[model samples]
Target: TALAENHPNLLASRHQLAGAYLADEKAIVILKKVVEMYETLPEDHPGRLALQHVLACVNLRDGEPERAVAILEVVVRNAEALPEDRLNRLVSQDELARAYLNAGQVKKAVAMLEDVVRIRKAQPEDDMNRLSSQHYLACAYLAENVVEMMAKVVQKGPRRLVS
Candidate 1:
């Protein structure tokens, strides 16, 4: 039954249901509907940001990182709008950086990751998030063969873990 879904509770059932679609060929269609619903939801509605975040993932998985970049850039701009929602912005940045890299735009990827590293370093966040940005930036540096920078990041070992 539709009621028996991946999301454990009613609170996230709709979003969770979307997850089921994420795994199926039907994902694209379901995602389109989700984007529509998401657009109709009120600004600052409790679940809206999460929904948009998921939609961005769907776009990426559908092999449309450029589209993901568009969605994520908007999400990034709103990072400070919701402190609790900042994680989504961070995630989007990570994906957007990769999208740029995949598109043969390593310079842009490195630039994006550089900004990510700076923001994450300046703010208080979960240790994992800090680690993620550090790792991503490190890889971006390495990919560009910025050996000096990569070595520094490697030496640091996830800024939080280093300290």
Candidate 2:
């Protein structure tokens, strides 16, 4: 904690600590402080965006889907400059879709997850990210009463399931 306070520019320690406490409510406090420290950074700065993403996850864990959605919306927008295959952008989109789902915006979640699923499809079928997007897309479809779409996603399951 002292080190983090002393070297405000050094986010690695603070980030790790925040991650360690993510399951605890303390994570929100820690992450908020770290995010504030990075306020001087540009909105699209990778470090700042990454911190925001973690903060959003903490919000999600605390059942504050609206907050998560707000943070992730910005993260996604800023991440547009990154490559399409960048893990951070893909993961941010996935989390944002989840935020929409939890906030009862089922249609928005379905639409967002559809894009994520489409992008992940180009990756290896068994890739964790691809599978996760597919799973969430299924959930979104289920929530939106699109049972046929859900069934189609299920049919395109990972190789192990297909076998």
Candidate 3:
């Protein structure tokens, strides 16, 4: 606490602490505080955007998907200035899709995840990010009741899974 107070801008430490607290019910409070500190940074600053992403994840975990969507929307928009293949931009897009899913916007999630999956497909098939995006795309399809899409994803098999 003293360290946080003395070095409020020490985002790396704050982010680490927030991660450690995520399993606790009070995680939202701690993450909110960290996000507040990050507000002092520029809107597009990587640290600020990364903290916002974490906050959005916490919101999703707490069943506050609307809040997660709101936060992730901003993060995704800001991240657009980054290169298409940038890790942060890709991650922001993926999380935004997840937020959409949790918010019950299955169609939107499906569309976004499809795009993410397409991008990830350009990476090595063994890439974890590609596999993760494909998995999420399948989940979105399942949520949308697109059984054919889900089946295709499943048929891709584990070895073909991207990110």
Candidate 4:
């Protein structure tokens, strides 16, 4: 709790502690507090979406997949609404897709990822946005192991990303 005392609003530290506690049975209170802190933050805050993703992950680890799914759904909706920052939205979408996978909503995860892949593919090859999308999509693909596709995705990292 030293980190929390020093930086109460620090999202990453809170998320890390919650993640650790989630593996134990004594985590509900800590996780709830972390979620509360994050929930009060403005939607567009830098760590807002990341906090939500962590909360959802904690919920999943707690065997509360329904709650995790609900949180992720809202995250995806919010992501879709933020047009000025499409890359941020994409990151949220990627997190939501992972939530879906964790909740065993495989179909939803695949469907969401299909769109992510399409959008990434349409980006100008030299754009960082395309590279990020590819990175996340590749991660999702590896998570699902979609028919030996990992080889193709694994090979594209440095190539897709132009320094």
Best by lDDT: 2
Per-residue error for 63 in candidate 2, Å, reads 0.5
| Model 3 Cα lDDT, one tens digit per residue, 1-163 | 4455526556677688889999987777877877887787789988888889989998998899999999999999999898888888999899999999888899899998888888777899999999999888999988888656677889988667776
The pairs that clash in candidate 2 are none
Q: Please provide, for model 1 over 83-120, each residue's C-alpha lDDT reduced to its tens digit, 9 standing for 90 to 100.
A: 53366667767777876665556788899888778878
TM-score of each: 0.64, 0.83, 0.81, 0.54
Instruction: Give lDDT: candidate 4, residue 33.
Output: 68
Candidate 1 segments whose C-alpha is farther than 4 A from its true place: 1-12, 42-46, 83-85, 122-126, 146-163
Better of 1 and 4 by TM-score: 1
lDDT (10s digit) by residue, model 4, range 1-163: 4455325556566667766776675566766666677666777555666667667766776678778888778777767767734777776676677667777666677777778768667678877766765665566666667634655766767666565
Top-down lDDT ranking: 2, 3, 1, 4
TM-score, candidate 1, is 0.64
Could you tell me the lDDT of residue 142 within candidate 1? 74
Candidate 2 structure quality by residue, lDDT tens digits, 61-156 = 889999999999999999989888788999999999999999989988999899889888899999999999999998998888865666677888
TM-score of candidate 4 versus the correct structure, residues matched by position = 0.54
Listed per model in order, the count of residue pairs whose N, CA or C atoms clash below 3 Å is: 0, 0, 7, 0
With a 3 Å backbone cut-off (N, CA, C), the pairs that clash in candidate 3 are: 128-163, 129-163, 130-162, 130-163, 131-162, 131-163, 132-163
Question: In model 2, which runs have C-alpha deviations exceeding 4 angstroms?
Answer: 1-9, 146-163
Question: RMSD in angstroms, all models?
Answer: 10.5, 8.9, 9.0, 11.4
Error of 4 at 34 (Å): 2.1
Off by over 4 Å in 4: 1-16, 19-22, 25-28, 83-88, 101-106, 122-163
lDDT of 1 at 98: 74
